[model samples]
Target: MSTPSGNGDQTRRDIQQTRAELGETVAALTAKTDVKTRARTKATTAVGGLRGRVTEAGQSAKTRATQLARTVSQKASQRVTSVRQKSQHTVGAIQGSAKASAQTAGKAESSVVTSARAMSTRIGSSVRTKPLPVLAVTGAAATLAVITYRRRRFR
Candidate 1:
């Protein structure tokens, strides 16, 4: 009876040892799996953060480009408007100068006509009263005066 009881005691001790080793292995494997899961989650979050930053940078660049283009177009339109206004003013000035020149020409023509009538009347009176030699000399002097007056008037 004493020998059988010692064998039973040894067998029970070996079974208990095996169970303890199996429990330790399972705990270790569970801890490693938990650590790996945390590392993978952290990496995924970092990638998402980088993606968000890149998207924001792209949107900001597009907004700036649109604003710059609008500003350039507005400035160009203003410059074109300014040029158009200057051209219109120049055209108006030219028209005014032409009208004034036409008026001056009409006045000069009227003066020339009056001078021609006066010269004709004086020549007729001189021809009626003068002696033949005096009339010939008067006619030659009148002809030279008329020629000089016409040259000056036209100029």
Candidate 2:
């Protein structure tokens, strides 16, 4: 049978019923507290295991990184030392080459000076013998070269 109650009274009754159900549910949960505890314990153990694995992985990575860094540093140092030795040898070779070139240049200069003086003496003797003919020939050659250069330039 439907109760003849106002809407506000019906709402209060529904609220009271929900509160009673909630009380019973709380009692049931209280009784199963041990089960909840066990579930929580299992979850805690799983999380601890994951934490251990993560810590171990981090440590392993750190050790490997340190080893790789050391190896790279050692190799780089060795390469630098090798390059330094090679540069030293190259510098020594360049110095030796420069010294040899200087000596050769000095010898060539001395030879040129001696040859120039000897040629000057020979020219003086030749001028005494046939000065006029040599001067005329030189003038003719110079004029011919100048005329040829002008013709080529115009063309």
Candidate 3:
């Protein structure tokens, strides 16, 4: 069987619990009614998110720029090396050509010198052996040159 005292005690406990729940509901309503505070909170949260995105984007751009710089630097170095190699090859070719030309000139010069010496010896011997014939030939050569010159001048 139920006792009247037990029932009364249970009713008081229920009333107290209902009052506590009502107070919590009123506090929640008051907080919702505070428009300025709610707006500030929302704006603060939005600004925090925007800052995070901005930071990430800035870092990404910086990384891309660094990569581009490195690429440009590497390409420039490669171009320099290529030009250096080509110039070296060209210089080597020129040096070889110069050496060959010098050798050919030396040979030609020596040949000319030898021919001149032989001609000088022959002319000396001929002059010693036949002075009269040499003088007559020289006089004839001079006369022929003067006649050829006069013809050209008159023309």
Candidate 4:
């Protein structure tokens, strides 16, 4: 009879302790479910997500700009190289034309000199062989020159 009474008392104590722990758990759950606290937590999570997206967008824009700059720089370099090659080709053509023209001019000058020398030799030989006839032809040419000069002056 005494043992049964003690067991009954201990069971009541255990039940009371369990009831107190359950009450504390319910209170904690109620605080966690408050509307203001839940809204604040959600807002903090949303802001963190937005910030991460913005950072990602900024990095993407920077990478695209860098790629575009490199492409533009490469194109400019290629254009410069093309222009330089074209200019070199044009200069080569001009130099070749100048050399050919110089050669032609040299040939023409040589031909003229040779013809003049031949004509001088022929004239010298004719003068030595026939001085009288040459003097008579000279007199006639002098008379014609005087007549032409007088006609121009009268006009």
lDDT of 1: 0.66
Question: Which digits, one per residue and each the tens of the lDDT, describe model 1 over residues 1-155?
Answer: 36698899999999999999999999888977897887988999999999999999978865775565455555555655664675576556555555665577655455555554655565566546644534444554555565567569869
Worst 10 residues of 3 by lDDT: 132-141
Off by over 4 Å in 4: 1-5, 98-155
- Ten contiguous residues with the weakest lDDT in model 1: 130-139
| Candidate 2 local Cα displacement, residue 34, angstroms | 4.8
Question: Best candidate, lDDT-wise?
Answer: 3
The RMSD of every model to the true structure, in order and in angstroms, is 32.4, 30.8, 32.9, 34.0
Candidate 3 per-residue lDDT over residues 31-108, each given as its tens digit: 999999999999999999999999999789657755655555555556556646755765565556556655777555
How far is 107's C-alpha from truth in model 3 (Å)? 15
TM-score versus the correct structure, for each prediction: 0.39, 0.45, 0.56, 0.52
The residue-level lDDT of candidate 1 at 41 comes to 89
Q: How big is the positional error of residue 28 in model 3, measured in Å on the Cα after superposition?
A: 0.9
Q: For candidate 4, give the lDDT of residue 125.
A: 78
Candidate 4 residue lDDT tens string, 1-155: 35788899999999999999999999999988898989999999999999999999978965775565555555555655664675576556555655665577755455555555665576577558856544444544555565567569869
Model 3 TM-score on a 0 to 1 scale: 0.56
Tell me the TM-score of model 4: 0.52
Question: TM-score of model 1 relative to the true fold?
Answer: 0.39
Runs off by more than 4 Å, candidate 2: 1-35, 106-155
lDDT of 1 at 95: 55
Q: Regarding TM-score, does 2 or 4 come out ahead?
A: 4
Which is superior by lDDT, 2 or 4? Answer: 4
